[model samples]
Target: MQKIFLVLLFFIASSAVFAFQSIESDPIAALLRTKLELENPTEKLEVSGRVLESDVLVHRFYADRDFEEVWSRNGILLELAYEMRFEIRQAKFDGLVPEDYHLALIDAYFQTFEANKAAKKPNEAGELVALELLLTDAFFKLAEDLELGKVDPAKLNGDWEIARKTSRTSYLDLLNEAIAKGEVRQNLESLYPKFTIYKKGREVLRVMDERAKADTLDWKAVKLDKAIKVGESHAAIPVLRERLNYWGYAKSQSVLDPKLYDSTMFLGVKEFQLRNGMEPDGVIGKNTAIGLNASPALLMEKAAVNLERLRWLPDTVQNLELILVNIANYQLDYVDKLDTLFSARVIVGKLYHESPIFTAQMSYIVFSPYWNIPPSIARKEIIPAVRRNPSYLSQKNMDVVTFSGKQVDPASINWSAKSFPYMIRQKPGGSNSLGLVKFMFPNNHNVYIHDTPSRSLFSREDRALSHGCIRLENPALFAQTLLKADPSWTAEKIDQAMHQNKEQIVSLPRKIPVVLLYLTFWADSKGQAHFRQDIYDRDAEVLAALKQ
Candidate 1:
């Protein structure tokens, strides 16, 4: 009986000690310690509309600091917290929704704390702790999203092979340094992509956002039902002229016919076409009409989508010397540190066989390359033509070759068979399918940039005529530019090799990087945003994933 009474007395004394410690404990730290223990995970870690992107890091952060509250001291909010709030509100200019980082909740908590402080209510402590957690959460989340991205590229597109930013230090370290140095906003801004185009895009987005907030309508596009040309009357001309004038295109007065598509409108149309990556033919066709109908909302979406895509690339891409191909625009640019050395027209793959987006290294230039026909092209095209015309092989200068690459006589083989056991090889010559030269880049897709015998296709604005390879407009000039750095391969030597009618390979001294992409929205060096058609229907997928 005495032992039982002593155990009860010890339990009572322990409960009293625990209650005393709880009364003196830090509520914010205590709440964080308790909440971090529970697990509630989904596809994204979110709670009450607040996206905790770095939930694991948030946990580790508090643990590393021994669950000490950084945003407040003795229930008084720190100035750093307000600075963080200002940055969060400014994120709208960065194409990010501030509410996702607990902006609304934090504002409400601040208001409640003010009311409680004025009324001398005890619940002010709870509001203070809530505000503290939210500010810490917001800082951590912004850091993660700025350094990396909100959505994973691979999750949206399977062929997204662009490398993400690499860093030696963890985000927790960045957070610690940011708080210790009292530079939360600067730390977040420092993670933005340093590319010139990205900066331009951000500025454009900010202006658009400001206009949206101000309820100021810049201009509304007018869609035409039929193709309109100069010297023709159209009902949509008045609004179209007004829109063009708003965009800084010159205007000319012609009181004779306000409804007519006049020369003044023609020049404005050409300028619009040139800026939007159109053919600038001064004819309002189906594509031009689509460009004209780019509502402010759609333009904003384009800006946001392209910005997200740019974030996937390494920011150092702005400084690197490389060959960039915009498949959507059907253009290739050889740029050195964001300056275009030269640009050329290119014909990429058709809609059915879209040119893949990836990066590789151009290793060598093959002058007068022999066409090793893929089995699909041979079976579908060459065999059918050969069976119809007995002299097809001779006309194309192609030889039926055995498995060992030895030429075999076509006369000895049976032509009526469904399957052809031998491969067809086109000899290197002027009439060769691969005109003059081909740039080689080893990849799993077996795609490369090459010159084409069908040069007339390059003149077409929509140059998605090739099977899968990229066909350059002038291969000889491209070769000269690529080999200009090497003392052994001069312009004269490159010209000689291209027309020599003999296959020769020249390995580059160092491999140059090649990036093939399909950005429909890009900003020029002059700070004008350019938009193009989504030829591959890829933007919708990315935009949808972004909203998610």
Candidate 2:
């Protein structure tokens, strides 16, 4: 009897140790701890000793000890762990959230603790697994968003890390190398479902099947000799011919003349150049030659890259009339429902002041808006002007105002002092930097689209001239387009309002979505992939992150 009792006691002790070990080294607990550390490195949870008890033991303790202390402790710990897991999972899904959301999440963590304390059983498995799935879904979503439906399988498979590291090659070069060599071309559609390309200006490059490859001619084999014809009916002889023929005017065309340039061919070249957004000069310059030599494959790649950029934008097409600034094209297209009512040449922000890609609702249109010069502009332009001429403010209809709204005479303030707190406002007039109209969309960037007095700058094809806000070439027409959306208003009415020279606020009946997107490649209605220069070097950074 004594031996049997000792053996029973040993068994009980071993079982207790095993139970304690299981609770202490639980996988769920470990996961919770890891997530907690990731989220709040500075904060430490004060876990009670009673919270370390196993779930079964805690239940027994609750039943035996009148549903107090130990049971409450276990429930609190479980709730805390669950909430931490959820937060980690949410972060994984969002990739990166705004700082305000983080604060909300912290409040949610505490709320979970309180709710779990009252519940009889915690949703332990469901919460943990759900969080993991949410994180996975978010990651996949980010990938889809970045791809913009034109993901190249081979490019995706290419050593993204290596490509990113090689600063010598541009993003396009890296993509080309990967697609050509990585055997990834076959998987492009699977990776990016949203992308489509064009071939021969007539056929859409839908599928990269074996039959499609067989049918398609290599772009290199399609010689310009057969494609372009010289005729009297051509737009301009010398300009047209130069663009049509590929023989880089490095050497005179033997078919035309040894000494004299072919005038007929030049006109065709000029016509082609004008249509293709190139300088319409009849002479085949370096840019024209580069454009001519660019293969169909290269153009397709550009289209894919641009499609990826579009994915970052919101899917909603708001009904209101708005301005769309295409940074790559250095142009703004005022799209009004079914038609592009007004097109304008725009000077976008420079490299340092790159026009950010974001969406905003146009709240109001300010006619003859006063230009409250930004601090950067004041320091860069205004201060210099005042130093050169003390009467600069008076000449430009600008007044320097103190914090109390009292106007400080320019002569009294030291122009060289950086500590001065003053506001400079340009009075509303034709000469005012904001010109006739300014579209306001309040954002953190404090940037807006407006008309400018510098109309000559619009003539330049590569117009990255502004500090940050877009300067419209034809603000009057753009304003008319917006007003015309409501049948009640007429163009004559808008013109009359502008001519009044008073500050006018026009509100859209419905808010329109304005997407200032960055796209380096896109297809025209004819299905030809139009490639533009990468004004902002985003592709390289994105490609690098993708590879990693």
Candidate 3:
């Protein structure tokens, strides 16, 4: 009996030792314990008191729990944190770790996830994944801060000298290495917290990816000696063939004939230019080459930055039939039931006179809307025009009115007087500055979309030409589309009202939502983000806000 008892005791001790070893060996389990240790005493892991009672937070928790149930076998909060840490470590390898900006970054990610959930449609799983990646990046950044000996419980709010001291060259080298290895692309949101140019880089990367997939010709294997001459241009046939392939024009077994270079290759270049939203001409210009040779990593970064911009948008895209103006793209899209019904190129407010981002409803469409000359315009444009050409107001049918509805003659009003309390109204006419039609969505900014007599400006790629209002390319067609939503109205009715050149306000039968957004990057139907220029320099402002 004593011998049996000793053997049983030994077996029990061995089993206990094995179990302890296994727990210590498991990386995930170890990570969970470590995170719990860090968070539990710090109280940072607790849900914010302010948020806990809010509708937004409640909805978010439910959505996150649902997502966890679906993807992680109902993983506990600690499990989620551990997975986040792993993701952060992965992001750190790509130089995208979000050091020193932990709480704010995490909050941003959660807020975005919550907003996406509250949107009441199919959750953008892509956006949710991006947020998770962002959280991971934050963890790695925090880890990096600790490694650099910059982690201070009290000094967390202040500037970290270590991050500031890091050389730009080293940072860029690390990023480039990661890009080359395809460890991370520019469009990954993890990079946005670190780099300002990430947004621009993403746009370039997307274009590069599209160009690569489209182009089938391999230039690297071609011999430079086998050059062919066509028309007035003389160059390597293989190089030309590769360029064609890169632009998605070249097919397998397709050999470029020397004589067809001017016709085929030149035409192909034009098509490429057109597709990229550039000026189309049958020429392999410097701009075209630069655009074509742009790296994919750079473009991806731009997309990532743009995705950050999307977070600034309201959680719920209110109003069914709405007009959305993408400022960076200099374009307006009319969406009904979340479907794009009409689109037009628009000349938005210039950088100095930037159109503010807000949402409103199109209550009325004015046929021959009166152009109320703003105070700034009155002080600068009208006063200068009168000084140069006194009949300028008359030629444009603009009448100067006193505050009491009394008409003041433009010739009589003192040009030098600073105390002029006068309102300028451009009369309804063909030459009216507001043009034939104006889509009105009254907001604090006092801005709206309208037609312009200056059609020549629409041809330019950079259409930030307006003072504050949006100038649409095809206003008549746009009006027709909007009006057609009501069965009683026809395109003929809209045309008649415009041709009459009378000021007629047509209230929308159903109010259409207008979202004047400032998104620089957004994914299209293909899940590819289309990037636009940061025309208003809003990226830095947004980035600053995010950092805070």
CA RMSD of all predictions = 5.5, 17.5, 15.4
Best by lDDT: 1
**Cα lDDT tens digits for candidate 2, 517-544:** 6666556665654556666665654444
lDDT per residue (tens digit) for residues 1-548 in model 3? 99999999999999879755754664333333333334444233423221111222222332332322211221212344444434444332222323433445555655554575477443343434333434433433333332222222223332111112221123223333443453433223332323233334434444555665665544343333332333434444446546666546554345455524555566666666665555675555544554455444444444444544443333345335678887777889997765778998998988788876667778889997778888888887888888789888888788889878788877788888877778988888778887898999887778899998999998886788888799998898998888786876677787788866458999887888787766665545444434456677655543443334
lDDT of 3: 0.57
Q: How many clashing residue pairs are found in candidate 3?
A: 23
Instruction: Name the lDDT value of residue 291 in candidate 1.
Output: 77
Model 1 lDDT tens row, 424-534: 988888888888899998887889999988988887768888888999998887888887787777778877888866689989888889999878887876878888898
By TM-score rank, best first, the candidates go: 1, 3, 2
Q: In terms of TM-score, which candidate is strongest?
A: 1
What is each predicted model's overall lDDT from 0 to 1? 0.79, 0.53, 0.57
Q: How close is candidate 3 to the true structure, as a TM-score?
A: 0.59
Residue clash pairs of candidate 1: none
